[model samples]
Target chain A: MIIANTLADGFVVFLTEAHSWTNDITKGAVAETDEQAESLLTAAKQAEQTNVVIDPYLIPINIEDGLRKPTEYREYIRATGPTVPIPS
Target chain B: MYRYDEFDARLVTERVEQFRRQAQRRLSGELTEDQFKPLRLMNGLYLQLHAYMMRINIPYGALSSKQMRQLAHIARTYDKGYGHFTTRQNIQYNWIQLKNVPDALADLAAVEMHGIQSSGNCIRNTTSDQYAGVARDELEDPRVYCEIIRQWSTLHPEFSFLPRKFKIAVTGSPNDRAAVKLHDIGLRMHQNEQGKTGFEVIVGGGQGRTPFVGKTIRDWLAPEHLLSYLEAILRVYNLDGRRDNKYKARIKILVHQIGTDEFRRLVDTEWQQIKDGALNLPQSEIDRINAYFTPPAYAQIDDETESLNEQRTQNPAFDAWVQANLAEHKVSGYSIVNISLKSPKLPPGDVTAVQMDALADLADEYSFSELRVNHRQNLVLADVPQKDLLSLWTKLIELDLATPNIGLISDIIACPGLDYCALANARSIPLAQEIHQRFQDIDKVHDIGELTINISGCMNACGHHHVGHIGILGVDKRGKEFYQFTLGGSSDQNASLGDRTGKGFPADEAVNAVEKILNTYIMVRNDGERFLETYRRVGMKPFKEALYGSA
Candidate 1:
C-alpha cells in the first residue's frame, strides 16, 4: 500500500488504483508482490513531484477476514484516526 | 505582561508577512515539501499524525487578559475550537489547516505574540516560574531577566543555528517550582553575602533520551553579566558540541562527555573575551525592563483571615478548593489561584475556546486581568483577592474548572502522544485519562498528598516523566502498547531522575501497577511524609514486591 500526506493540508491520503489520492484507506490500491509495491511507490513519487502528496512510502498490509489491514500499529493509526477521542 | 516596543512589533509583523509569502509559495507549487518543511518548522508549524499542528509561545508563561482572549478567538476561528497547553508553557492547535496558518500568525502578531523561536535550533522561549512576581518566597521577579533573555536570544545571528534546540528556565525562588534543574541552562536568583541579588548559573540539564540534573557552574554571577555569561556558554557549546548524531546533539550530552568542571572552564575562558563586551546588560536597560514588571497598585486592606474562616466553616467544598488550589501571596489580602485543566473528563492540558474565554473574563474580574500557564499544564490567576475566594470558586465550579487536584495524584502531566504527535510509539493521553479516572476522588487524592505522575508517549520525555514521583513511559513491545514505570523522582529544589522498576506492563496492567505502588505508599507512609518522602525512605524494594508479587 502506498500512503502519503497531501501537500496542501497535510492530511493522510492513500494512492488509489487510478493513481490518484483518496482520503479513505479502505478504497486504497493494494499491491500483492514486491515488484507491484515498488511500481506503485514509483507512481506515487511522480505524484509527489507534481505537488500532490509528500513523504510517500509503502506500508505493508495483511488481508484479515476479507479486509485489508495495516501491519504496524502506527500505520493502522494513520489509516484510521486516533485511538482516543478528540474534541468535537 | 511585557508590552512590545516598536522593534518587537516590527519584527513580529515582518516575520508574519514572510511566512505568508512562504506558505503561498508552497501552496502554489513554487517550493517542494523538502524546501517548505524547515521554513514552516522555523515558524513552529508541524505536520503531525492527523493535521498541521501550530505551537505558539507564551513568554515566561505569562498572558494578559487581552492576549488570552485573542487566543480564544484564534481557537474558535482558525482551529477546532480548542487548544492544548503544553509543558513548556506554550499552546498547540492540533487541527490547524496549513492554509489558515498565515492568517493565524497575523492574528497572533496583532497581540504581540508569534510562534517564532518557539521551535527550531535556536534558543526557544525561556520559561520562568508561573508564580514569578507574586510568590512570597521569591527574591525578585525572574520574568525581568526572562524578558531580557527573550530580547537577546530572539533572532540572534550568532547562535541561531546551534547543535540542537536550546531551552533555558529561570526561577527566582529558592524552592524551585519552575523545574530549573531540568533545563539546558537554569538561572536561580538569590542574594550574595552583601545582600545583593544575582543568579546561580547551572548548565547542561535536560529531560530527553539522556536526562541529567543540571550542575552549578558558578556560585554567584552578577546581574549585569547575565547576557554575556549566557553568550559565552552558548559560544562554547556551538563550537564544540556534537553535531554528527541528532540524539547526541543536545548540550546535556556535551556536558556529560566532557566533565562539568571542564565545561565550566571552557565557558570561563570564553567569558574572558566577551564578559564586558556588547552583550553586557547595562544598569539602565535592566531598570527599564524591571519597570515593566513593577507590582500592580494594591489597595490598603486588612487580611481576610476572619472572613475566610467563617466562609470555610460554612462551605466544605470551597474550603477544600481553598486548601488545595490557593497559594500564599506576598500581599496580605491576595491569593494565587491555580485553575486545573486536568479534569478526568478531558485530556490533561486541553482547553476549549469557550473555557478560555470564560477563564479570561474570570481573570479580569478576580485577578488583575492577568493569567499564567504553568509547566504542570494548569492555569493561574496570580493576584486573586482573598475576599473574593468564594465568589471565584463558585464561578469556577460553574465553568467545570474547579478541580481541586493541584499537586495531588490526579494531577498528571501528559504529552500529546501517538494520538497527535508523529514521534510517539504509544498513546499517552488515553493512559493519562485512565489513571485520572481511577484517582479522581478528591478526598482520596488529597489523602495521597503531593504526588506527581508524569506520562510520556515515548522516551522523548516531553511530559517530564523523568522527574515524576511515578512516571509512566509508553513503549511499543512486539507491536503491542506497553508502559514502563519509574519510581522516586522529584523536580523541585532537590531534583532527581526517576529510577526504573523491574519490567514493563501492558496498558491495562500499568494502571494496576500504579495502584499497587500507591497502596504500598499509603501502607508504609509515616505520619507526615509525602509519597516521594516515603519512597525515598523505604526505597523501591517494597514497590517492586507489591507489583511483581514478592518475586
Candidate 2:
C-alpha cells in the first residue's frame, strides 16, 4: 500500500508498505469503510488518464490503515519527524 | 575535444530548432506550465525558485578554450555574469530568462555544446576524469569511451522515459577523481590479466535520501559490450524501478530491493538478449570518436626541476600552491594545474564571467587551447608547461583564482543550496562561506592537510556529500536549518560512503563541530597522517568522542 498527501503544490507525502507489496482485497472496487483512500484512488485514477497506468491494486491506504490495529508488517511513511525522537 | 561529425551536428541542430519551436509555443501560451515543464526540462531549462536555470553539458569534463569562452559569453550576456559548476562537471546558469533560452541553445549549439539530455529522464552527460587524457595513471583516455557513450545515449528512444534520471560516469585514471562509484553506473577503464583494456562496471551507486555505494556487477566488460551492457541495466531499471514513489524511483533503491546478485542475473539475462546488437559500437565509429580525443602534438622538453626548485625555495606561497594545485601529468615537462574556484569569501564553484574569460585566455596561452571543469568544481589547465608555472600562478593569483587551497580543508565542494536552488532545504552557500571564512588562515589549513569537506543543500547529493572526507548535509528542521555530518567517506579508487557521525547540528554550530572534529584528528593522528588516513586508522570513535564528548 502507498499513500501520499499533498502538503503543498509540489510537496507530497509518499507512504509504502514496510516490508512488501500490499494486497488489494477490494480489487477494482473501492473499500466501503474508508473515505480518504477512496478519494486518493479517484485522484490517482484521474492522474493516470494517460497511457502510463497506475497500478490499481496499489491503492492509497491512509485513513483505514492508520485506524487499523498496528502490526509489525504495517506501512511506514517517512513522516516529517524522527522515527524515534528522544525527549528533550 | 569530441568534435561533432555530420550526424551529431545535424541532431544537435535539429534539437535546437525543436527547442526553439517549443519555447515559442510556450511563450504564446499554447502550453501551460505543466505541459511546458517537461518540454523545457527535456531541453535542460529548469524553472528554479527565482528564475530559469540552464544546465550546459561539458562532455566528460573536457572543453576547448573556444567552448569555454562561449560559456563565459553566455554567463556575461544571458545570465548574471557568473556560472555554478556542478558536481556532475556541468555548469548551471541560474538566471536565464525563458525568452532567451532558445537563443542560449543556439549559442551553445554554435560551440558544439547543447543542453540536450542534461535534464529529463534520459541518459545524461557522461562525465570522466577532468584530467582524462593527460593524467599519469590513466590506462587510456576515458573521454574516448565517454564520447562513444554520448553518441549512443543521446536522445536514446527506448530509455528516454525511464523510471527516473540515469547518470553514468567513466574514469580512466587509477585515482577515480570523477567519483565514478557514486553514479547510477560507474565505469572504470581497466586492463584485465589478458592485458585487454575494458571496463570494470559498477551499478546502482547513488546518494540521495538512500545512499549506497555501487556494487561491482561486471569485473570485466569489453569495450564492444559497453552500450549493450548499459542498455541492459537501463532496461532492468526501467522495467522494475519503482515509479509510484519519486524518492524510491532511483535505480539504487531498485537495486537495493532486488539485491545485487539478483539484479546482476537479470542484467546478464538482458545483456544476453541485446549483446552485439546495433548499439554494439562499430569499430569505425569508435575510431572516429577516438580521433577527436587524440593527444595534442607536443615539443619534447626536459623537466625544469632546477628552476622549479629555485622558485619553490624563493616563494613559499608558490611552493604551497604547487603542492596543492599541481597534478602529475603523463608528459614529463607538463602538469595539470587546478585553479581553485573555492576562494575564501567567494561562493564555492562560483566562477565569474571575467574568471571564465581569463581561464579561457590562460588555457589558450598556457595549455593546448584546452580547459577542463573538474568534478571538484575547479577549472583545470591540463597541460601547463613546467617553465610557465610561476607566471601562470601569478596571473591566476591576480584573478583571485590562486587560493592555494586545492585539496585542503578550505577547498570545499558546495551546492547552491537554498541560496539558489529551490529544492534545497537549507542554505549551503552560507555554510560553505562560514567554513571557508573559519579556515581562511592558510597556515592552519595547510597543517590540516588534504581534506575534502563537501556540502549539499539537500539530500539530492548534488554536491556529492556522501563521498566527501567530511560530508555535511543540510536538512530543514521545521523552518530552521540543521546540518548532518558524515565521516571517513572517499571518492577515490577505494570509494566508500561516509558513516553518519550521530545527530544533526544547528547551522551556526556546524562549523564549530567540524573544527572540534578536525582538532581531535590533528591530536590523535599517527606520524603526520592525512585526515582520511587518521580517520581510517581510528575509525569514527575518536572523532565521535571529540564531537559529542559524553553527551
Candidate 1's DockQ:
0.67
Question: Where does candidate 2 chain B have its weakest 10-residue lDDT segment?
Answer: B25-34
Which candidate leads the pack in DockQ? 1
lDDT of 2 by residue, B20-62 (tens): 8887776665665567779889888876544568998888888
Candidate 1 has a TM-score of 0.98
lDDT of 1 by residue, B1-551 (tens): 79999999999999999999999999989998889989999999999987789999999899998999999999999888989999999999987888899999999999999999888889999998999999999899999999999999999999989999999999999999989999999999999999999999998899988999999999899999999999999999999999999999999999999999999999999999988889888999999999999898877777899999999999998888898898999998999999999987788999989899999999899888999999999999999888999999999998889988888888899999988889999989988889888887777888889999999999999988999999989999999999999998888889999999988999879889999999999999999899999988999999999999875
Which parts of model 2 are misplaced by more than 4 Å? Answer: A1-88
Residue B219 of candidate 2: its Cα lDDT? 95
Q: What lDDT does candidate 2 reach at residue A73? A: 16
- State chain A's TM-score for model 2: 0.28
Please, what is the whole-model Cα lDDT of each candidate in the order they appear?
0.92, 0.80
Interface root-mean-square deviation (Å) of every model: 1.3, 13.7
* Model 1 stretches with alpha carbons more than 4 Å out: A62-68
Taking the true A–B contacts (Cα pairs closer than 8 Å), what share appears in each candidate?
0.60, 0.00
